[model samples]
Target: MSSVIGKRCVCRVEVSRVEWNFLHPWQRTPQSKSTGTAFVIEGKKLLTNAHVVRSATDIRIRPHGSTRRYPAEVLYFGPDFDLALLKIKGEQEEIDFFAENGKDHICSSGKEPDAKRKKFLHGLQFATDLPALHESVHVVGFPTGGNTICVTEGVVSRIDFLGFSKSLMLTIQIDAAINPGNSGGPALNSEGLVTGVAFSTKSHKKNQPLSNIGYLIPIDIVKNFLGRCQENPSTYALSPIIPYRFHSLENKSLRLAHAVPDTVEGVLLTSVCDSMKGFLAKGDVLTGIDDRKVSNDGQVQLRGDETIQHGYLLRGKFLDEQVRFSVFRNGEHVISSPAVLRYIPTICPRWESVDYFPDYLILGTVVLLPMSTYLQCQKGCGTRLSASTTNWCQKWPHEWEGKEGLVVLTEMFSHEVCFGYNRPYWRFVETYNDIPIKCLAHLRDLWEESMEQAKESDDRNGDSNSAKTFSFVRLGLEHSDDIVFEVRAAIQAQADILKQQHIPCPSNITQSNPRYKS
Candidate 1:
């Protein structure tokens, strides 16, 4: 292990967090503390994992051997790629962290004069190329069980590739002992330069036999992530995908069914975004990308003795970049001009969504929440949703419309207004007062309007005791019978339920729920 790389480049990240309490919608979890590793990079920014700063209220940085900590802010928290960029909050102020006489290299022990905290003398440089398989590497971090920085050794075991922007997920698997608090640390080569960033370990579950197997986000992914950050200089990084799905044409019968000649070998385009409907179609044989010829198994030559999936060629490219794709359709080999792949919507948006707090609305005593990947993982949640609706979009994911989302009737307070209706804990709400429900906000608006209309209807009836008896609002549900509640009684039940439950708000929404657009 190189002493200079660990001591000078890496810094310990301390995070103070106050997370949302999903179980109790209106409340927040207690403040908690966590630590991870970050290293200096070009532009005076620190690089680390997004999970390190998740739900963070305050973040501080302590350079190796320094007792003082400096406050910092996240520049880009890319949860999609599990990476983040940060800088000292007061960098605009007198940034004496680096002395005036400091050297340009990151490993330099540039001495500071009268400074309370040590300055980064230099930023770590990325390797010009990826380390070959079996190359020994050093993992540096301030892992748990110790306060000082710890260095571990490992060998690069594998590097796999596939997909468009998602190809960036193809990380370097290493036989390293990566543990809690080691996240975002750099994997250094013999020259002590950064080759990869430590991100994950295989099978983190207890009782699992997996050990000595960790993964590093390689330089290519780091560079690609940094490149996408330029699209929005002040926000978190997100993976912008190209709407393309290619399947292997490995089988003889399958290739023959697609009308491919015996001499031709390439992958088949199984699905693409609606924007590509006229240009490409399902079952189209994809022959090449630019000048590179694709193989039957969807692989393409990277160079002599090296091969990668054809989509890897497009990994570094931006979403707006037009790619020259060659395909065989209707018995003709066509060389098409550049086509800028479009953004497509997903059916179950909750899966891998980056929301710090999810959007939810309370209708009287009923809780209306949107379906998401995160919601599906909690408390046997996968079964909470009706399989008929959840499976429809999943089975034919391409059929899911843009801006479409599910609004589930996930909860109900133990009030007399909803006493007769079955719990239907995770059933979806399809309509309100006979009007279709679009999203959580839309459902809220409908309920509010229905209450107002019910008030108007009561005014026309003029103070009759019978009129107070039953003006109703109906909520339709999937996999359950309609829930009928007296309008005025249900609205009053909301305040009663909140008071009894110690909830301050009727809903947990800060923004109009974001829908993945077409």
Candidate 2:
């Protein structure tokens, strides 16, 4: 492999982000700095890990062996695939300088060529096929404890669905030393072709003692991200997943109960999303996807003895494309026409706004925020609230069909009006005055409407001298709890509570009503 590949192609990324404090719910830590690696791709874009630039307030990129830093912005980000595309921003002269100097024209010794210069940098080409088992590969990146590009050699150890970014996707496991700054670096094959992008590694456990188990985002996923970016240049279009639980048909009793024949080898569908509720019932068994036959263990055979999770068939195809499925229903082989792949919004999104502050609403003393993976990480799971939130995040409940978003009471400020509500934070607000809380914006609207109603009621009663009372009913541990307070007194105390707590605003209601002021 030519050493100029690393010096001319690989680049270092610097990011500055504001870390939010989930516990305080109102405090934001100072600007935090992080670094990673990226490489130039086709179309004058840079490819890197989504996590590397997540929550970034400012991003700058410096080409290998260059001190000049150029500002960049995220063009597209796919959290599921953990891939992001960035575009460099600056004057034409600065852009042309990096574009010209960062090409593969420079020699390995970091010297400019004495002959004529090449017009374009030789971008790494992706491997046409998946890397074979034990295939030699090289990882190049700017790892920690160094400012220059580093290279590590390894082989493809395994390929399977690995859990990452709160979901499972196809990943290539390599025996490479992947460190902090090595993320988003390209893993090249023996021919110096890009095979994968280094992303994560398994942590060493005292009992497990796992080592040399770094994972890479495979080229298929990278291609999918790039393809989606080409289709939609402004944002990412993630592949739609068929929300269904599959169980192996190896159980004899289960097969007999479903009237499945011994010859039929396919996985049983235990449950499906609301959209597929009618088309595919619980007892239906998925026999095949497209032309691929699904085995009893939910595995699909690819070319030349490669068997992977059947879900990969759907992943490989584009969104809205029809995929034919062979199913066995009522002990008879049935060929379903085709189901169009589409994205279904989860009840709780894994990553909400990647480059901005978490959206929150503060009404009175309650700090309400959306239920997300970030919040779940901050507030450890296993508690009643956390467990319930996690469950909701995994499976969208039929009861929450019309609701736009799930807002949880993350924290509460101590105030005279909210004294007895010591039921702990992270609880989901069922309703406000018997009206279902659709989302954070709806919750804010409900509170403001309730206050207005209370003021009107005070006027109608001809009790101009009496204080207005506002009632807020919430779901409690055993039953419903009524939280009643005087509107004027609560409003007066809210301002003081926000100032004392150093909260920037009472609530972030810009999404719904931009004109709303604290």
Candidate 3:
């Protein structure tokens, strides 16, 4: 039976991760241990949720009913999809034995087979079609209570787009109880085929407890993620957002204003991104995508019985691929040209690369860091600084594409040189030496240049008593109150300040830095 196959396929995964402290930016928190479930897929690979192994320093897997632990390496991870594929390391013989026997072999000599033995491992098959609502399904995994494989029966309650890990993706809501440790487990259909991967559950509100609200990454999304990996094995391509706000054109007044025909049913584009600035104008009616007719409510019929968001048609599309659209523009039905999909850089990047150290720079007592969603969350979200910075963070990348980067003055360590400045943390850096700052790396370059120029000027004058100085403008500060500092004095004091503060380095250079290449 497929249920029996699931029991043999499900495995327990343990991850040891070292999380970074956003407050300090460079320092890391103590190592932490977390457990989740994974199941074998094609190619002898284990599939699991990305969050299960986020920031993981080491990953180990124990197959069902096996006491032996095998090391595994992440081959592919998609933060947006919350999926990760792992290839087990150096346990081919043990894995093969377990695959054939469904348990660890107890040899007479109490010794496992050596490299001479060869065996085959089996993987679970995925359903070719989407599961229907109310279809019987089984949730298999090692839940929080114990390490034993557990199975629960349920029905597919609903299938829709739900927010997971800060991004909206297609999900299947099941009535089964999906608790901690169940993440990355497989949800199998009646035939024992994989329907989706168990992921998130809705939390209960105060005074009200929610039930049977677990969500799974739908099979289509899983397939899309796998296909993307196969296409580009070297680089991870992020899925693009629609880049437009949609509104229903069911109202007669809006329909008449846009000149949409009565026979046409479509949604009105309220706003568009800068990339689509001229090609697709606001107030244009989107009637269809790839020849699929869209409903007034921004939905399209995916199949005979399934109607999904019109955006679903754009899923798994590469950045270079173009999508055809039918639109009502200027009171006429037009077949619009193919528009290529592209990903926009966001202020808050996904936490997929949590293992990486944050890029930061320290000058004298002031700590300069780039503004990110992670940083905003670490600091109070409701604070005046957070609120003000969030507005700019939400702005599309195209709005400031020319700018190299956006950075903020995050912290100020007390020093005699910066005595009366009363540094405002979270204030955006507008300019350095009256020149508009590009990015964090560019800011560092400007600082280096300013210091060198100041030194040259002092040398040209041959004035040993004169001090070398540089100045910068803060976004909210007045021009007359520019923050100024003596470059030579600050440089002299940097070593002492860093030692006193127990800082390992003055800055963590990023790949984007030109110095990194050199």
Which ranges of candidate 3 are over 4 A from the true structure? 1-3, 91-120, 204-209, 274-279, 304-306, 352-357, 373-390, 457-463, 466-482, 512-518
Candidate 2 per-residue lDDT, tens place, 381-496, comes to 33776666656666745646578777766666888878787664556776776677777778788777766876677778666554534444343221225455556566656787
Best model per lDDT:
2
Order of models, best lDDT first: 2, 3, 1
lDDT at residue 244 of model 3 (Cα atoms): 73
Q: Is candidate 1 or candidate 3 better by lDDT?
A: 3
Q: Cα lDDT of all candidates, in order?
A: 0.72, 0.74, 0.73
Structural RMSD, model 1: 4.3
Instruction: Give the per-residue lDDT digits (tens) of candidate 1, residues 1-518.
Output: 44443366688999999876665556777899999999888787889987888778999888776666778888776655678888888854217543321323323355432221232245677887888888999999989899998999999987766221222456788898998899999999997778999987767576573789888888887887787777666443345454567889889898778778988888888777666666667778888888999899988886566677666666545556677778888899988877765444454553233543466777788877766623444555545364645464443344744235667776788998788676546777787877887667788777788778877877888889776646677889886788888888888998899899887788765452243212
RMSD in angstroms, candidate 3?
4.9
For every candidate structure, what is the RMSD over all alpha carbons to the true structure, in angstroms? 4.3, 4.3, 4.9
lDDT of 3 at 58: 94
Following a full C-alpha superposition, what root-mean-square deviation does model 2 have from the true structure? 4.3
> How does candidate 3 fare on TM-score?
0.87
Q: Estimate the overall C-alpha local distance difference test score of candidate 1.
A: 0.72
Question: Clashing residue pairs in candidate 2, if any?
Answer: none
Task: Indicate whether candidate 2 or candidate 3 has the larger TM-score.
Answer: 2
